[model samples]
Target: MRRLLLFLLFMVTTGAIAVFSVQNATAVSLRFLAWQSIQLPLGVLLVLVAVLALWIPYIASAGR
Candidate 1:
């Protein structure tokens, strides 16, 4: 029963994230340096940043 509740919670949270990502995807752009730019969905950028952040901590700690 507890596991089922947790699973439902996870599903709801993920669904919310998906909906938010889809909505924001169309309204984002990136600017780098002067006179350089590219357009991308916010969700893609966020996922890339998240992956980098998660990996950095693990990589840094691995050497210790």
Candidate 2:
């Protein structure tokens, strides 16, 4: 049951990403402070940020 739910969640996220990327094909750059990243699809950048948001908390909890 837990595994099935996780699998379903994964599938949904994958589908969402696919649709978002297809809908947002425009290239854009990201700049932070003095650094910048090359042009990338806005959908991909958003997904990467989402993954990082989830990952940071998980890593932070590992030391406790």
Candidate 3:
């Protein structure tokens, strides 16, 4: 039952991302302090950030 719930949650999150990407298909740029980034699709940028956010915590805990 727990595995099934997790699977459903994963499916919902993926579907949300897909819908968000399709609706927000626009070019965007990032700037922080003196640094700047090249233009990328908004959805791509968001997905990258999401992946990094999830990965960073996993990596940190694994090192301990």
Candidate 4:
């Protein structure tokens, strides 16, 4: 229950940030592995990173 509420709060905050970024800028860009990419919003990136962090422990454990 608490976890669900926290997740919902995070989603709402990320959505708000995305909307704000879109309204203020033409687009956001990101660079990775010597490659350049665009299209995804900052809010989406934030959420993705958060999810990746959450999965890191499980992924590391699976290696064993």
Candidate 5:
């Protein structure tokens, strides 16, 4: 039951992201101080950030 709940949660989150990406399909770039990034879709950037957020925690816990 817990696994099924998690699966449903994941599916809902994925669907939300998909709908958001489609609605906000605008190219953008990042600039910080003297550093800058190449243009990319806003949705791609959001997904990358989400992946990094998940990955960092997994790496930290594994190091313990």
Candidate 6:
């Protein structure tokens, strides 16, 4: 069933996030050029960066 498969995928993604966040419970700072970010949870920052990596290209191509 498609719904069952989707449900399982959701569960697996959440489980992965839980494990990753638990394992990477450290604070870190990020900087770029003249910009800087305050310390944030390592896992949280990584997830945001990963999402942006995928999102920026998609947005850039959306006009075509």
What's the TM-score of every candidate structure?
Answer: 0.55, 0.69, 0.87, 0.50, 0.86, 0.63
The backbone clash count of each candidate, in order, is 0, 0, 0, 0, 0, 0
Task: Give the TM-score (vs. native) of candidate 2.
Answer: 0.69
Would you give me the overall lDDT of model 6?
0.89
Every candidate's lDDT: 0.76, 0.91, 0.93, 0.77, 0.93, 0.89
- Arranged by TM-score with the best first, the candidates are 3, 5, 2, 6, 1, 4
* Candidate 2 C-alpha lDDT tens digits along 1-64: 9999999999999899889888989998889999999998888898888899889999999979
Top-scoring candidate (TM-score): 3
| Better structure of 2 and 4 per TM-score | 2
TM-score of 6: 0.63
Candidate scoring better on TM-score of 1 and 6: 6
How far is 53's C-alpha from truth in model 6 (Å)?
A: 0.8
- Model 1, poorest ten-residue lDDT window? 28-37
lDDT of 6 by residue, 36-58 (tens): 99999988887888789879989
Please report how far candidate 2 places residue 55 from its true position, in Å: 1.5
- lDDT (tens digit, per residue) of candidate 1 on 1-64: 9999999987996687678778886746666666644676777777666679779999999989
In model 3, where do residues sit more than 4 Å from their true spots?
none
**Model 1: CA > 4 A from native:** 1-14, 27-37
**Model 2: CA > 4 A from native:** 31-35
C-alpha positional error of residue 16 in candidate 6 after TM-score superposition, expressed in Å: 6.0
Candidate 5's C-alpha runs over 4 A off are: none
Task: Report the candidate with higher TM-score, 3 versus 6.
Answer: 3
Quantify how close model 5 is to the true structure by its C-alpha RMSD in Å: 1.4
